[model samples]
Target chain A: MELFLLSNGKLSGEAELLGYAKRQLLAMIERRNITSAVFVPYAMIRGDYDQRAGELSQTLGIKVTSIHHAESPAEAIAQAECILVSGGNTWMLNQMLHENGLIVPIQRAVREREVPYVGWSAGCNVATPSIRTTNDMPVRNSVVLPALGLFPVQINPHYIDAHISGHMGETRDERLAEFCAVNPSESVVALREGSLLHVCGNDLRYFSAREQGFKVFRHGAETREYQDTSALRSLVPFTCH
Target chain B: MELFLLSNGKLSGEAELLGYAKRQLLAMIERRNITSAVFVPYAMIRGDYDQRAGELSQTLGIKVTSIHHAESPAEAIAQAECILVSGGNTWMLNQMLHENGLIVPIQRAVREREVPYVGWSAGCNVATPSIRTTNDMPVRNSVVLPALGLFPVQINPHYIDAHISGHMGETRDERLAEFCAVNPSESVVALREGSLLHVCGNDLRYFSAREQGFKVFRHGAETREYQDTSALRSLVPFTCH
Candidate 1:
């Protein structure tokens, strides 16, 4: 299985989508000799689906087609060479994935067919066991918590430590801590903006465009940041490469 | 129905819980001649329920007992004088309400029996028709979207326009706008910190201790801030007092 679970789609100053992971994405494309990709834009509630597909095509130099254009979304996933998921609303994305019966096909494509899966933000969220660790609001009335378990552990995308001045709501750290408290046995890998986790077969890698480390959150334990994938070995079968 | 849907329980630098709405709360207590409140602390994931109840007892000069100690949660709600909900995780709070069979009981208490309902943060989120507009993370496996419909329209508590300098995630406005886009017929009332919506019988009032106005978000319409409840008459059957 190959997955590029990015923390976010774009940085503040960068204009191109997924520009931070351009080097890794280019290497993956060349290694697999990929030319076309299937784009999943269900997470985008207010954006143009085909326009985003066009952006991804220009950024990655691939033939990108939105899955919505296909008559059957599941069939599109079944024959997909590469799967690209965009970031927007996690609830809507997961709901549409289930509603269109594309969950199992995407899971099989990534795990069995070794299809490269690239996702950022909400896309990164669905790669985990569940969407319980997502930062997006539950906008849809029909709530679906289960997601594509491409990655074994729960992940929190777009993780940040800074708080808006005088905002009385729970901070990101506090929200993650609450998740840890409720699910004591489970762990959440918080990926800050510009960071990502790359898993290929038995090898796992971690990268950050801003030279920042990722934090691991667990119940009854101190949340500590690490610069490598040493702490993730216990959660998944992948070894640091 | 008599309700106090508060944006938050406490403000920064304020030592007392629900201190920002003390004046209105006291008036409600006097109007109803209420002496005790049934505290629902299910939203509090880490804090001590009894300690919070004790703080409310001191702050309101009324006996505040956590419903966790009751033999039957539904029975406790049926016999309660006032229902007080704390600020915490909305997903867990709504789930617990459904699990303990308190949804209908609380609804009957607030609607039929005219029990004074006071909720802040997660509590306020659950007062709406659904918890879709909440600003908290969904940290539970079983996702429950239905909430106590004391308030007809959806509300976003702890709403803020300011953003952390470099966070790439959607802002509060964007998230609410996405909600409006998905639910075009519905509107979201964005309540800032230290703000609240009070409904007494057939009269509706809006208050913000910080003197800030609340914003109304709807699809294909301008998101505007309002200092009064004149704009909400169309959404609910209440007249501005």
Candidate 2:
């Protein structure tokens, strides 16, 4: 099993989508001899699905087709050699994944077939056990908190420590702390804007475009930052870089 | 119904909680002859309920007690003269309101008894028909998007235009826009920090501790900013000040 879960699609000052980790992504795609992949763009609330597919195709030098074009989204997931999920609204994305009946197929494909999976932002959120740590608003009337549990531990994508001055809303850290407080047993991997977690079989690796480390949050404990994935080895299935 | 929906409890440089609107709150308490109020502190994830109640008691110069002390929360709402909700997590607050059978009782109190309602942040979100516009994370396992429906329209409290540099996550404006895009018929009132919307019967007024206006968002229409509540008259039942 292989996975590339990114914090976001594009970082500030980067011209291309997934520009920060283009080399890593390209290496994975070429190593597998992948020619084409299915793109899940349900999380994209404001972007064009086909255009995003085209961008990935250009960046990865492989054919990337949106799942919307397929007659059966589940069948598309089952038949795909690789899966690429885009970042956008988590609520809408998760709802769509459930509504279209692709959760099981995607899970089966990734878990059993070992199809390579790539996701960022909302895309990365659905890979977790639940959407509890997502930062997006619940825009829909009906909401389902449970998501695809591809990744065992919860991950808060696009995580940041900065705050907007004069805004009294809870900071990102405060929100994650509340999550930890409520789900004391669960841990959250707080990924910054340019960070990505790469999982291969039983091994996991962490990368940051800005040369910084990610932070791990737990209940009743001070949040500790890490420059490598060594700390996550004991928590989940992964080896320290 | 008399209501004071605050964007947040406290703002920068403010010495006391709800200090920005202390005079307005005092006026309402005195005018309504509200001797004591029931404080709903379910949204408060980390703070003590008694401490919050005590703070309000000091600020409003009236007897304020946390509702958790009551054997039946719904019974407490039925007997209360006023209701005060704190700011913390909106999902937990709305979920508790439904699970503890306090929604209808509180609605009856606010609608029939005309009990003055005061809420900040998550409190403000629950007053709306749904919690879709809330900015808090849905940390709980079971979530109910439908709220008390006291306020006819949805409100996004603690709204800010400021953005942390290099953060790629959706901005406050962008999130609201996505909400509008999904729920085309629905509208969102973005309240800035230290701002509030006061409802007195059919008349509604806007107040800002920092002397700032609020932004109104609707699908297909221009996102407009207004200094007063006059613009909200046509959207919902509120006599603009």
Candidate closest to the true structure, highest DockQ: 2
Candidate 2, residue B189: the lDDT equals 95
lDDT of 1 by residue, B13-54 (tens): 888999999999998898889999999999999999999999
lDDT of 2 by residue, B1-241 (tens): 9889999999887879999999999998888788999999999999899988999999999999899999988889999989999999999999999999989999999999999999999999999999999999999999999888888999999888888899999998999999999999989999999999999999999998889889999999999899998889888777789
Candidate 2 ranges beyond 4 A from true positions:
none
Candidate 2: which docking quality band? high
lDDT of 1 by residue, A65-112 (tens): 999999988999999999999999999999999999988999999989
TM-scores of the models, in the order given: 0.99, 0.99
Q: Report lDDT (Cα) of residue B191, candidate 1.
A: 96
DockQ of 1: 0.88
Report per-candidate DockQ. Answer: 0.88, 0.91
At residue A52, candidate 1 shows an lDDT of: 98
- Model 1 stretches astray by more than 4 angstroms: none
lDDT of 2: 0.92
**What lDDT score is found at residue A5 in candidate 2?**
92
